[model samples]
Target: MGPAERSVLVAWSTFTTTFTATRAVTHWIRDGHGPASGGITVGGRHFHHYNIGIALLSAVGAVALRGQERHRRHPVTAMAYGAANALIVDELMLLLDLKDVYWAKDGRTSVDAAVGLIGVGGIYLAAAPFWHRAARELASTAVHRPA
Candidate 1:
């Protein structure tokens, strides 16, 4: 995998871990309990842009990796990967109703987090091959692909 893919995976993993850990610890602060199945509420707010930061961070990582002496121009894949992540998260938000955050004793997190999860998962799936050399591989693929 390339640096871009690796960066995204690292970021996504970190992001999810951070969010999950925050939720577990701050469940009491957010509301009565942790994330729920059907959907969870966030400060009673309708919209939460969790992946915006993701996109920005991934974009930066991709750009930097491309400029580095060794790698080729696979930054676009990173961009595509990052874009996929953001797009998936946004789409998941709407589909899963991510506003609602709560978890039952059964370890059931809300469906609200589902979309974002899918998005995150998608990023990994895309980066599975070259997460370490993701930037280069993506660049290589970009050049080899017909269109």
Candidate 2:
């Protein structure tokens, strides 16, 4: 494939890896909690607030991609906003699952997690390389703009 397609693929893969990591942590914490407090306590990391950094990183990538795409400027912040919201949604899912409020009669809750991870993860993954390109473009434009 071409550069753009490759970039997109890389971004998608990065986001997928990020989501899977976050989900794994969430699942581990939910399963490990037995005292009704329901939180991760491994190697001194709570891991309860698990989505913040990844979401922020994705947002930055989103902005960078927007910068590359729109030399005229765009609401790249919206991408970040959406990612933040998705993070919250994932957190909610984790909480509900931990509370035992999420599950089918057949003990199926992983499906829900998988679906959200794919949907939300896809957003940031697509945004990452796009943002990186946008940021580069923006920098070039800025340098020329001053000249």
Candidate 3:
């Protein structure tokens, strides 16, 4: 209903959509169905989406932290943050292991991580009000109690 809630909903939706789209596009490219059949090669090196994700994440973080409240709460900002988060999460395994294990059996970890994130994100969005109330109550009780 409010700006914060709307932003959260937008972010979650964007994250899920971007994650699905990224996976499909990447798979298509990997299967030699896209223009960049062997992946985007520059200077004889393969370019990975995670790299773009990192950059996008950095930019979003910067804007969120340093920009005005309106900028921070903008739908575009939320979308960017969500999309970047999805991209990074999608390749979490590669970042963790610092290896090109994508498409390998080990790459399954990336999908696992993405799914876990989606689950957790959904839970948070669904229960955030309850959690906020619980936190406030706990804090109030703690402050009033005789320690």
Error of 3 at 99 (Å): 1.2
Question: What's the lDDT for candidate 3?
Answer: 0.88
Native-to-model Cα distance after best TM-score fit, residue 36 in candidate 1, in Å = 22
Q: On residues 111-137, what C-alpha lDDT tens digit does candidate 3 reach at each position?
A: 988888889889999999999999999
* Clash number for candidate 2: 6
For each candidate, the alpha-carbon lDDT, in order, equals 0.50, 0.53, 0.88
Tens-place lDDT digits, model 2, residues 1-147: 455544445444554554456556556656874462456456875654435745665666666676565521233343344344435445554556565433334224444654666676577665777887899999999989953
Among the numbered candidates, top lDDT falls to 3
Candidate 1: tens digits of C-alpha lDDT, residues 26-70: 455445453553233568744333445456656666756665644
Q: Candidate 3: give its CA RMSD in angstroms.
A: 2.7
* TM-score, per-candidate, Cα-based: 0.33, 0.36, 0.84
Instruction: Select the stronger candidate by lDDT from 1 and 2.
Output: 2
- Greater lDDT among 1 and 3 belongs to 3
